[model samples]
Target: MATISEATSAPASEAEALAFARRVLRDEARALAAVRDRLDGSIVRASRLVHDCRGGVIVTGMGKAGLVGQKTAATLASTGTRAYPLHPAEAVHGDLGRVRDGDVVLAFSQSGETEEVLRLLPTVRRIGASLVAITERAASSLGRAADVCIAMGNVPEACPLGLAPSASTTAMMAVGDALALLVARMREFTPEDFALYHPAGNLGRRLTRVEDVMRTGRDVRLAAPEESVRQVFIRLAGPRRRSGAVLIRDDRGMLLGIFTDSDLVRLFEKRREDELDRPIGEVMTANPLRATAGAMLGEAVELMKARKISELPVVDAEGRLLGLIDVTDLIGASPEDFEE
Candidate 1:
């Protein structure tokens, strides 16, 4: 028999250590593949049940399975299905009240015999909430009681001692994600809907509309195409916020061109101060790159990065000036967002 230290000892070589890690990964991958192969109408039925459920989903499990349940619940909620995680142990102590008629109770248990999880079966049934089980066999107490059973089959653990919940939990998480996403698909959830649920992270920022972040009103420097370059700059100099580019608009409020401060420096470099008094339109970049009003901020960022410009004009369908997107406005964006 191996002693605890012997079982936990570091590999004699780096190659050996890497091999063990790779083997563990392979084991988990195989487990997921097996679960995928076993999938049939049960998944479709479970997804439909959850999709049609009028009340929110109540996910319950124990220990590591409970942790997976929490993540599953979060995924479901973010995907447009309202869901909440309830610890099976806590349920017996009054959390069971969270389950109610019209709700779907999603229970997770590898053995299908976790005492805490199984104890909730009777109460869940009594409350009239439909039970959906993610377990190993249909004969298991939890599975037999479920209206829908997504049997994952028996997945061997990836742990060296074969005692930890590694592979099984991985399979459980994947199955949970599959079910949640299927329901999301059934609901025809859109990116706009997804953005509503994730409004604080990198994802939310990337999904933000150009118009939502673009500089508008007095903050945007709009100049008449007939105005002289010198006059446009002079008029825009006193605004509380300064934009790098001045949008040249026709009398009808349509965008004609864009002139940046860099254009002024170029005039000085070329000894063209004489042209500063000319109509700014001739010196401005005509038909400049622009983003549509409802376009995503990420699309604007990609355009600005690709064009290597510091400003992008936001316009409506008829080419009417809406606002401006300054590079400074995206300083808080993730480095990945700027990647091609």
Candidate 2:
């Protein structure tokens, strides 16, 4: 009944278009209100099903609900819920096998009469999987067959003609987000845990480790405490390393402190210039911060930020020095790690 251009656009000024959008948002608010006011025993039962689901969750829908289902599936998967989207059409082909008895199925539809979604309802029940439905009418096909029906109360469609799907899809998305977040919180979903699921995103780098960025092997500044300031300066200042010479115990080769050219002025200011002749113990920082080789760099930044230090030594869990890190040295680390 409509041309491609007409389908793509509506004839109206920008202000009129904005008014239509406002009306749609109002309808969405009403839909959210209705869903909240009508929530009953079904919500508790559905939550229980989700809690018991060891095999994870599968959310399915048709039409607009199907698009919302994809976002819901992705959110749940990212938030430690182990969820995936199962298209109603694809279920008939072979995707039905993805659902096991231990999985929870969430079916969403405004009219609850989508033939694609309804067709999968019987097999979902026959397979012994628990089902939860979200729809306006409790007696709707999908609603009636569900193990638990979430009543989507009477919120008029955002379409002025009351034909297009708008508010219903928004309400369904809110419900999906609520369920995912509730379950994720119950499981104590931490940033570190979430990073495993989102390794390529900014969140993953925010949880990155010091070992991932610190200078390793030959690039690390390591030397005995007994080394001459001249010899240490040759190795440290010669290479233009951000970190100065690190002093380790001569006997066990364990880290003790660090000595930098910055310390030279202060030493010459207070004591004789010849005192630089002493072992690094007298000239180096006696109590330097040491980090375990595997500690998160984000946490290390917190330490450095609080202490206002430029560089720190990396040590093993047993307190043996492995390498060092500096704020300037952060350039070699992943770029995503620096994001706010």
Candidate 3:
């Protein structure tokens, strides 16, 4: 029996270890290139088959191949293909009834001869559905039975003994990703589409709009032209459950300038104690760069970065005060979604 010591001692030098890693990556890349070049008719047909499915693509495999199959199904589903996994063992028991004529069966088997996989092929065909097999040999049972066989070719195992399924699995994953991406491009899936599928993710929250995160109703920072400087200072600084600056507007629905903590401090530094009693219009910055309520979060960040401004006012299309978007709020968001 092989042991961990035998496997550990196989690669005698760091150079050999590095070479093995590179070899696996290079071979997998080559497999992807081959698939790309060969995507002429088979990929189109397979994609169309999945697209036209009345049910959805039912992916199946066994062992390590099953893990890869699960990921492939998810990628397909996320990228516009209606795909889900069906375990080989479970299919044989009773799940075979789930296979419909309008559905496509995508089977993954590195060896192409996995008994569990071979046993499901007849039942897959019995339902009058299409099968797209991803395997290493064209002559293998699964490969030959599939209506569209995507031969992954002979990817040499990274294991020195040719026992572990290293390069084969990587090649399968690459093929799956390539197909998912192509189908996504074909269907013109956008980041907004991805956001719908992945709403609980960080990208979803970061992509969320000013209307989603901004305060409204009684919690909003609002003011009027007749407000005194002392009240504006209290609203803009120190405490209010929210911070940065306060949004001020005239009674006519026109936006007045904002009064930040900086403006308050600067005013106190330059004025007499009695001068603090002046109206807020004296200290507020007039005509600040403002945005609309429906503006994308990404665009808002860009405007902030360009103007070197920390706070921005949100208004309606006709220029009515809506709310405020802060640099600190965007900073709390992820850096990924904010990038172009």
In terms of lDDT, which candidate is strongest?
1
Per-residue alpha-carbon lDDT of candidate 2 for residues 29-51, written as tens digits (9 for 90 to 100): 98788887777777667766776
Candidate 2 least-lDDT 10 residues? 330-339
**Index of the highest-TM-score prediction:** 1
Error of 3 at 279 (Å): 3.8
Q: lDDT for each of the candidates?
A: 0.90, 0.75, 0.76
**Model 2 segments more than 4 A misplaced:** 1-27, 209-219, 233-256, 259-278, 289-296, 302-310, 314-323, 326-329, 332-340
The candidate, 2 or 3, that scores higher on lDDT is: 3
The positional error of residue 209 in candidate 2, measured at the CA in angstroms, is 4.2
Q: Candidate 2: lDDT over CA atoms?
A: 0.75
TM-scores of all predicted structures: 0.95, 0.75, 0.81
Candidate 3 is scored at a TM of 0.81
**Better-scoring candidate (TM-score), 1 or 2:** 1
